[model samples]
Target: MSGTDEASAREALRSGDLTIIGRIRSASNATFLCEATCSDEVVHCVYKPVAGEQPLWDFPDGTLAGRELGAYLVSTALGWNIVPYTIIRDGPAGPGMLQRWVDQPGDSDEVEPEGPDLVDICPPESVPPGYLSVLRAYDHVGNDVILVHADDRRLYRMAVFDVIVNNADRKGGHILTGVDNRVYGVDHGVSLHVQDKLRTVLWGWAGKPIDDETLESVAVLGEQLAGPLADQLREHITADEIEALRWRVGALLREPVMPGPDRHRPIPWPAF
Candidate 1:
């Protein structure tokens, strides 16, 4: 079957029959790589069941799947399209969130031998002049490696989205470089907390000014939070959490600059 559009993808996730093709063991939660068949087309989706989530001290139990969907809604409202199309539905395991899988290009990780556009992986010295350092790491062999991302506009947009959502866990692996050359973010179950726990690797733009277009997008999102989006969020999260989201939006709009990392728990452990 051919690939489906966003609307069709959402429909498939909602009504399709999910067949577990494999298990993604790397995730802390019980995540499944599934094939969802709606009508004539088969779409690939990642399913995270509420039943499989580990209890956390801060976030309420049985609400992570909804938060995953909430992140997608916020991304769509801002017109950033950072998160893939996602929906809450009943799957093989139980009720959960199913998101369309992004197919990333191989070139995202490949390194060229000799070219101006060579992709560098690890080692602080290998990073190109314009690239921004994201985090530092040590390999298993005790060698120093520096993680960095290209200085791109899409990265900036994603940073803004994470700030608005109060994302608590934004790791390097969560940022997918799709085959279409667009960046998509995944695994947002830990976001939208009522507390100020915005840990991420996209701090390269910290204290930087946000452009007009991005500011306009934030403004539009702020308006939506006061309207129907607020109503929709109430079905998934507590009223307090929704209000906290509003507070974050206002703070970002007022400053329009990237805030520095928290003194305590600034970055996610195992950043990649």
Candidate 2:
């Protein structure tokens, strides 16, 4: 999504209106980058509803709410600013996921666009120093911590939802860099895989070393998993899921790196 188009789409979204201005081919859906109009804000959202020939990897039992809710949960756990969203309406194509658009900072006297590409927030140079660092840390910790901290407890719960639904793409591009310099991830219709398809770039720092702060955070999260966090997951996810979530977290803490999709190849490389 380009900056100009993002602006226009945001305007339409604020009005609760939608105009399918363009199309994109994602691994899972034929995405339409549209302008959405909600009651108070205009957003440029990429609508991914059910339509067209089913992909080879589609999860038959997947629901839009399930996917959005999972992402929302994880974002909340990471202390990232992701808005609550829904796939409210169906388009000509089919059902679509409606999400809040992450606004880019304008090149003003006070707010300089520090990131490399406003479209896709990227490496250190493009981003305002501390911004990307925080995001990377969140990704690193979230991927490794699992059930340790309260925040990460929610994150693990969400990850379980992703596993149950078979989410195949948790790539960096799916994450959004909000105007406030916080990170928010979007897109999760491809989760809950019965197979091990956790492909992402958020774990690049794994196995190299674990910091005290990070290790301590993970330990806290692990303890939570058997306590209040465990109860929280029981409400939404199955008991098996809670156990699986704990197991995955335990595995990471034990070794930290065991090689997944992102470890070997680019899992949505060149994320902006």
Candidate 3:
């Protein structure tokens, strides 16, 4: 997004009037497609109301919206801009997390289809040469299918950001190519837990060394946590969770590389 568009998007999400357009039926939570209007600025966005969130065994009820906002703040602090512009405010459905919607290209569902969808599943032999194979599995009919993601830099940075937030669900569909052609991640309600529950599909960079630029971003994030970021996060997550975030950043800087996946439950179910 351009500078003016970014400013307008933030304004719309912060104090705009939100009108429910329709429900995003495929979402696990009660997510709605909304039209946010502020003065003359308007944009379509995704709104997930606290009242509509499903109770999860691990996360406390009604806290998902705050977590989503918290994740956005951390993303901004890191300067990765992985998450879209988001905020916690009163909507038509009550209070919720509102984020500017990104427009992705129209494409086919075929294994080798086109456009900005970086992650896909295809037959083992048909996997794209430029993509990194993540896992080998089977379809309902038992045909072989391999989950793969592109060897792109933007997506790689998102994977690093996911580690910092301890994102619990980073499915393939959550990774989108924005209208600006930047890679973005969404659906962060289950992120930033005190415990390590980092399940995601972007393990293509597993065990790779972190680049200097990304390490610098992580270091900046650590310093910010000591300043204003800590205070900002305290509003959404528990003090313990924020501390865990600090530890994660420090540990990453010490290691300076992408992490290997946990043999147990490394990826989210329904991978897409």
Candidate 4:
């Protein structure tokens, strides 16, 4: 039921016999929970078919799957492992994205009780210690609550990765704590736009200096864009979008600081 080798996992995802298990109804785009069996090893994954993509006014039709893969490529270039292993291939519905499912425990079959969330809404007066507050707001009933994310470094790394990709929908629900104890970000179908459309709930580290290590990673990613990474990204995004990524990276290295929320649409609707 498992394949740990990187090459093996990639091959399995690329050619494994896939069986749709169920639909994750919460997703706006059609999303299928599937079991991919390859070489007799089974791996659970999420599949989104291009045939089911909803038309967007801004983004071109049927390109979301490629955008998801583009985000994965940026994550890989940074050596951050921020995104799950992802690929685009033909499926029962048609060609689309195939991403390895992240187990809640990270790699276990035994289901563990859901643990503390990486992001949460808490009483304004009692934001959890070691958590940084993002926004203060009223919930459905009108009581005051604050949007907060963990003060953990992994989340910060994700936040930086978000900046690099210009992630436009980084809802709190998209952040996951996996079994290997790593924080991951998912659902990046609406990223890599040429225009600025950054929206997220991960503003806890806003206005802080990025760590030297991460800045170094950003520098490396900026350089990769002019070469192989840009070539691969062209399969999903436009030349202008790739160039915008280059611009964002250069700007970050010049500033080396976590950005404050933009004046327009700083956070996504329904923060959680």
User: What does candidate 3's lDDT look like per residue over 72-99, in tens digits?
Assistant: 9999999888998888889898888998
| Candidate 3 lDDT for residue 251 | 96
Kindly list the per-residue Cα lDDT of model 4 for residues 32-77, writing each as its tens digit: 9998888966778999999989999989998999999999999999
Q: How close to the true structure is residue 48 of candidate 2, measured as C-alpha lDDT? A: 62
Q: Which residue pairs clash within candidate 4?
A: 105-179, 106-179
Q: What is the lDDT of candidate 2?
A: 0.48
Q: Which candidate model has the greater TM-score, 2 or 3?
A: 3
The better candidate by lDDT, 1 or 3, is 3
Residue by residue across 154-238, what tens digits does model 1's lDDT show? 8788888998888889888888877777889999999999888898888888888988889899999999999999998888888
Q: Point out where model 3 deviates above 4 Å.
A: 107-116
Off by over 4 Å in 4: 1-6, 106-115
Count clashing pairs, candidate 3: 0
